[model samples]
Target: DTRKVAVFVGSLRKDSFNRQLARALERLGEDRLEFDHVEIGGLPFYDQDFDEDYPAEGVALKQQVRAADAVLFVTPEYNRSVPGVLKNAIDLASRPYGDSAFAGLPAAVIGASPGAIGTAMAQQHLRNILSYLDMAVLPQPEAYLQFKDGLIDDEGRVTNQDTREFLEDFVDGFVEWIDRQRG
Candidate 1:
């Protein structure tokens, strides 16, 4: 069966490595996963007052996430932590005190970076937030890819054989995790 996934990419850059990573993952899991790239760039900074009358963009974000079978976060480290934009998106989705869009969804976090540790710190912080939001996040086989030029193409093709194999395994594990979560 195919699972719909709401993919949240943390970077706003037009050519971000994290976005490339997300695309690669989508390609790798295409047989079993249908990816919907959620837009977070245009969202206004979350305001509690708007909860009474949520903006159309915020409502759209929540609806998209709720419609998905699972969630995937592709983030880049910013000052050793999760990027502010991603945090804002999460806050916006999980707000209004009990109308969270993320609750109970099976989720996974992965990132790619030019740095050696990839986005490890950012991923850890994001995991904590996801846990608090009550997401069933995948805990094993953590992927912290050290991205280099030509590692993955803009169209999500993994050029390196080793990297492709590793990502394939990651995708397999994620599919299994989603199945287990649904069961």
Candidate 2:
């Protein structure tokens, strides 16, 4: 069976390492899953007033997530918390009080940072929000990419052999987790 997944790349930068990680995950899951990613940079700041007519992008994002079986978040640490853009997207999906797009979704969070902690603090911050959103997050084999020079090549693809292998396994785990949650 095939499942669709909405991949959220939490960084706005073109050269973001987190985005690179998301791309790698997509490659690993290409054979078994449908990977659909939504861009967050153009989303306006979350506003309750707009709930009546959500922005075009927000509506599209919600629709994509609602159609998917799971979500994958690849984010970066910004001042020890999830980036505002990412959080904004989450808030957009979690709207209309009871009709959140993220409701009961089997989700996973993976963070990357140039810092030594590798976005640990930011991932924790996201976990808190996902808790209230009722998303089932994968708990093991956590991926925290550190500042390893040349791990990402000039083309921004993951270039390190060891990290690539680990990500392959991680993608498998994510797919299995999604299946279990659906089962």
Candidate 3:
């Protein structure tokens, strides 16, 4: 059986490296997993007052999160942490006091950046937040991709041989973890 993975891209930019990384992961997981890119760009900032009467976008986002077999976060670092948009989405989905959609869900995080840190700090921050939401995140083979020009081609393929191999291994490990969790 195929598992449905909800992919959350943190950046709203049309040509974000993180988005490209997500596409690469999708290509690598094509056989065993089906990917859906959940749009967070339009989600309004989370508010507790609207918890009972969630907006349509927020409700749709929650539904998507709840229906998925797993979650994949492709984030970019901003000021050494996760972007406000992603954090807002997390807060929105983890609301209504103990009715978090992410509770006990299997998750993995990966990101790409032009900087040397390669979104390491952002992933760490996200990990802490996901821990609070009680997600079963994969612990090894952490992917913090450093983006260089031509690292990814126009066809959404990872061009660097080393990065390609590493991402293949990373996705393999993620798939294995998801299967184990399914069992």
Clashes of each: 0, 0, 0
> Pick by TM-score: which candidate is best?
1
Question: lDDT tens digits, residues 104-132, model 1?
Answer: 99999999889999999999999999999
What is model 3's C-alpha RMSD? 0.9
Considering every candidate listed, which one attains the maximal lDDT? 1
| Candidate 3: regions farther than 4 A off | none
Residue pairs that clash (backbone atoms under 3 angstroms), model 2 = none
* lDDT tens per residue, model 2, 1-183: 678989898888977888777776777677898888887888888899878877887788789899999998999999999988999999988996788999899988897787889999999889899979999998877888785766766554668878888887788888899999999
Error of 3 at 159 (Å): 0.9
Show pairs that collide, candidate 1. none
TM-scores of the models, in the order given: 0.98, 0.92, 0.97
Considering lDDT, where higher is better, how would the candidates rank from best to worst?
Answer: 1, 3, 2
Comparison by lDDT, 2 against 3, better one: 3
